[model samples]
Target: MISRRAASPKRSTPRLPHLAGSAFRSRSASPLALNVMTIITRFLSLAVLTLHCVAFAAGCTADETSTTTTLSTSSSADASESTKESRVLRHAVFFSFKESSSPEEIDAVAKAFEQLPSKIDSIVDFDWGVNNSPEGLDDGFTHCFLLSFADEAGRAEYLPHPAHKEFGDTLRPHMEDVFVIDYWGDANEVTDAKSDDETELKHAVFFKFKDDASEEDVAKVEQAFAELPNKIDSITDFEWGTNNSPEKHDDGFTHCFMVTFADEAGRETYLPHPDHEAFVELLKPVLDKARVLDFTTK
Candidate 1:
């Protein structure tokens, strides 16, 4: 819900039209009677002016009240959308299959995992793909699945949901080691899958800072990092947030930044851009360790 902080409307003094002085004076009238008549005329004119002001102010108040109501309604809608977006809980899973598991078995597990969002109503976003990065940083994990939930309650429901449990059963036999990390963040930067072969690239960066790094240094890094898109045109979408998960799988990483590019060439330009190099210079001092993962959307 939108909270209104608007001030009360101030009352304004009405500007009265000037009246001709001689019009209220009668030439043939007695002095006493003229004086009384003048007083009575002035009173009536003043009363008319006050009435006109009241009527005009009332109409203005009515119109202004209607406009405020419309603005408030629109703000409430925006607030609702923001709240929905903010509550997104990202569940990231990296799976490594056992040596004995065949490609067909792994493919079956992947298919079953992909069906979870359709089976569960709480799942807001879902994407899964095999590791296709040229960088050898993926370790042994080959498959990555990203799932989004609207809230913790949605995740709670999903944890024991029948379909999820069934998928877990399917994955249990084939999986050699599984690494799961959950964080409440904005994952809307990642796009959905398409039926066509065309796929976009996502650059995911995780940062672990030195223990002595101050909040100011981190804020500076964040501010400078946010300015990169303005300097480079290849960035399609960008979002970053601090880690908010209680899960110990984070491995001391606290910040995640995801940048989207239209193609690998776009990423190539972004990597070599002088602006990116400068930003990296600012980040290098406080950054103790970093991991980068690049993948194409499925």
Candidate 2:
């Protein structure tokens, strides 16, 4: 009944010597020291931020340089490929059949020559036609056959082909004269604009430069010939190159130019064209022999 009051709980203050000392020292610090420390801290933060920005900018520049280099290389490669695709080796053949050969025999010879392309894989394209130009400029040639190849190697393969040799054997009997000229030219596709139906007149011009003609003279002649299409409205297409055939059958003809027209009217217009006449005058001095054959595509 008379229980003693529970002993009162002891009240004790917690020890904080380290915290108290630090707080007292901070409060006693000079304003100049505090400002100096704040300035140093801000300067260090800015320096780190500047370094990060510099690193990021350098990385971006390197990436951009790499991308630009790659694009340049790709563009150059594409341009080279386009140039290669546009060029080809052309083998042009002109024939004047013997008077003794009948039409049926000539037709057989034609059919036999046509078959060589199918047999020889090197022949990329083949086309033939009889002379139809009223200009009387074909020099006794009656038939024109144009064969296309990818390069000199393709032409090399074609020249010695067994099928081509057989075709030659078949053609030699009735062939009064055979003119072969090979050159490099544009690989123009026969599209609607240049289709056989529209642009069929082919004016094949072959040249044998004089021994006295300098390289520069020949170059001038070649340049003048190339400019004909630009000067004459009737010229639908024009391509030219030097002969590079290994067959030794070109008979000294060095350069070949193939000019296309829509019809005989176009040919008629082109022949008397002032530009063409001027070109001929320019060519006269350096030219040794010139062979021109005009035909409509069959």
Candidate 3:
């Protein structure tokens, strides 16, 4: 992490005391004895200086070690703060009810899901709606729900919460096909039903690659997908990311891409564009299963 404050310099070693030669001199002693006394005093002073140097070096090492530990701790804390500020975990769910299920039953399931955030504290945001796309590409899925968490830990808490399990029980009997994709990305802050009161069309596409697909093959698909906006003119906004949730709820889908259109006319132009057709062919060889959910903001 980048530090806002400047680093301080290391403290300097202190000076040793000066030794006086006159203290070692004995005026009453003979020349040889006086010479011996002077030598012994000089040796003892040199030893004291050596010991001081060693102790000073050790102190410097200790200071250096302490500073390093402090900086490491500061960086870790800053990184935690950055993660908190920049990212959010998104839980994307799509459900297709069985033929035997009644309208009242589906409504109950939806209401039960809406009430989950009240029981599970980890869910920070929730949104749900019925499908409203004309493309007929949703693979039988009719309802969609999006749940947001502040971080992965919050998501972790939400998945196993009793409320979530209860909601699952409500959904299981009527569920036909379920597709889930959770990932970390920028938090959604679009609270308005429509942008400027005009219905906005959203194209949510989920992809599951073949088990044998190489990393290179996946990269190629990603590159081709990203190039669609430039190849087609109707795409107003686009974003893509990989799954990161640990809930095991993804059901083999690993990548999600969302494209926003200003209106249904924009989406119609994109569906049959030559570039898009070509991109689909590129995805076919390594693609395992794919699902799409297109909806207009209510």
Best by TM-score: 2
**TM-scores of the models, in the order given:** 0.66, 0.73, 0.68
Summed over model 3, clashes come to 0
Candidate 2 segments whose C-alpha is farther than 4 A from its true place: 1-33, 95-106, 120-124, 131-142, 150-162, 165-179, 192-199
How displaced is residue 73 in candidate 2, in Å? 1.4
Highest lDDT model number: 2
Task: Give candidate 3 regions above 4 Å deviation.
Answer: 1-25, 30-40, 100-108, 133-136, 156-173, 188-201, 223-251, 259-282
For candidate 3, lDDT tens digit of each residue in 74-125? Answer: 9999998987676677788889898899999999998998898899988877
On the 0 to 100 scale, the lDDT of residue 99 in model 3 is: 88
lDDT of 1 by residue, 1-298 (tens): 2344336565688754354476345455567877887799899999999999999999999999999999999999999888776557877777889999999999999999988889999998876777766656666778877788878888888988999989989999989877556766664543444566767787777788999999999999989998898989999877777776654667777887777788989998998899999999999999998766677777
- The positional error of residue 214 in candidate 2, measured at the CA in angstroms, is 3.8
Global Cα lDDT for candidate 1? 0.80
User: Residue 103's C-alpha lDDT in candidate 3?
Assistant: 97
Best of the two (1, 3) by TM-score: 3
TM-score of 3: 0.68
The count of residue-pair clashes in candidate 1 stands at 0
Compose the digit string of candidate 2's lDDT tens values, residues 1-298.
Answer: 3354346565587654364544435755568877876788899999999999999999999999999999999999999989988888888888999999999999999899888877998888887888876656677989999988887788878877888888889988999987788877787742224454543788888888899999999999988888888889999889888877666778788898889888888988998899999999999999898888887776
Ranking according to lDDT, highest score first: 2, 3, 1
Candidate 3 overall Cα lDDT vs. reference?
Answer: 0.82
Q: After the best TM-score superposition of candidate 2, give how far the Cα of residue 273 lies from its true spot, in angstroms.
A: 2.9
